[model samples]
Target: MSWLVTGGAGYIGAHVVRAFQAKGIDTVVVDDLSSGRRSFLTDDERFVQGSILDGRLLEDAFEKFHVQGVVHLAGFKYAGVSVKRPLHTYQQNVAGTSMLLAAMEAKGVDRIVFSSSAAVYGTPDVDLVTETTPKHPESPYGESKLIGEWLLADQARATGLRHTSLRYFNVVGSGTPEVFDPSPHNLFPLVFEALLDGRTPRINGDDYPTPDGTCVRDYIHVADLAEAHVVAAQRLDAGEPIEPVYNLGSGDGVSVGEIMRAVAEVTGIAFDPEIAPRREGDPARIVASGELAARDLDWRMRHSLTEMVASAWEARRSAPVDNV
Candidate 1:
């Protein structure tokens, strides 16, 4: 039986596929190619081009690929844009997840590993967020993800479905040079784009209480995050009990100013980032404890701040100029 990774052609999803392949696991992909790039996929991997919303299509993929487990990563991921397109977000995230679960039930594919977001916690009130943090999502995207988790819980209660959800923020860098984050809303890509376009990157706020007077946020390497996902799936397949949720985070966190310095140093560019006023609802510091993940999922900050910037910069530079 093979593992089916939904949205496997996407940046992070592609890395997950590679991770599974590295462990000698047979895997298949089901992606709609909405935001996912076909160039990121490999020729050896079996591919199913379709949306997760089509339960019949999912069932077909499951049966054809002999899918025993799923890593559900297909969804509308933009948080800010979700506000403008709330209905679209709900349909893609909520309805799509429901359909995936239904198909899993019909096909008897019980194991699932969901890709959730830290947005489900909104702007957390505490300094360090854990699994037990209050869930008061600030955007429709976050709410939809929370609902996705609840759907898994309800399904597990109804049937004996085994599952886990990984919530995280600012996933950056590359596990393989073939895959690079192409998100416009993401900080790493935004900064990399600015430098490549001969423009200065800007920091929104520099007067916060952080060590460098900038807001602190977690920035985990994509490779580290993907490893945890594979391990979680393996444990579930072995019938080992796992935590319902885990936070892939950097306990100390990195600031925007520090990231700017790293970008300049790594890219051989020397210019301070332009600083602007802090955006409303922006928290000064919001990092999470990754202790639980480290204990159970083999999680750790394997890459440093400069390493993160360097790897991301290398991948971005390696891509074609027109690919932008």
Candidate 2:
């Protein structure tokens, strides 16, 4: 039996699909190709192109592929845009997850590993966040993810479904040159796009109360994040104890200024980032303690900041101009 990965054509989802494949686990991808690319998946990989809101499509995929578990990553992912379009965000994230859960119940798919967000802790007061950190989601996107976790928990309590949620901040780098991050909203891609187009990369706000006077955020490699999903799924499949939620994060964060410097070094481009006004609702620093995830899922920051930048740059440069 194969595991179904929703939004498997997206960057993180593609890496997760590959991670499961590396462990001799089969995967069937279901993506609408909204923000994901068809080329992100391989020819041999099973793919069903449709929105998760369509319960019939999900049930058909489950039956046809003999699916056992699911890795739920399909949703509207942009926080800034989510603020302007709360209705669309809730529909795609909340309503879509509800539909997927309903389909899973109908098809007897009883396990899931949810792709959650660190946005659930909006501008946390503490220096280092933990699993127990009080959730104060500032955006509709974050609120929807919290709701997704609630759905999983409530479903598990009622239907005996085995599930876990992974909350994380910045996901950077590429596991394979074939699969590069194509997100227009992510920092790495935004910087790379600016550099590729011979434009200066702008730091949102350089006056924050950070060491470098810019916002600091925990950054993890895409491959590492993908591996954590595999581990979470394995624990569920093997009936091993798993936390309802785990934070995959770096206890220490890297400043945006530091990131800009790393980008300059990696790309061999020497240009100071333009200082732009801070966007409203932007936090000064938001890092998390991954001690629990490390203890449970073998989570660790395998790649350094320089490695993260270099790998992302290499993969970004490898992509076609139009795709980037």
Give all TM-scores, in the order shown. Answer: 0.99, 0.98
Total backbone collisions for each predicted model: 0, 0
Residue 61, candidate 1: C-alpha displacement in angstroms: 0.5
> Which candidate achieves the best lDDT against the true structure?
2
The C-alpha stretches of model 2 lying farther than 4 A from their native spots are: none
lDDT (CA) for every model shown?
Answer: 0.92, 0.95
Segments in model 1 whose C-alpha atoms lie over 4 Å from true places:
none
Clashes of 2: 0
Q: How do the residues 136-253 of candidate 2 rate in per-residue lDDT, one tens digit apiece?
A: 9999999999999999999999999999999999999999998899888899999998998999999998888878899999999999999999999999999999999999989998
Looking at model 1, the pairs that clash are: none
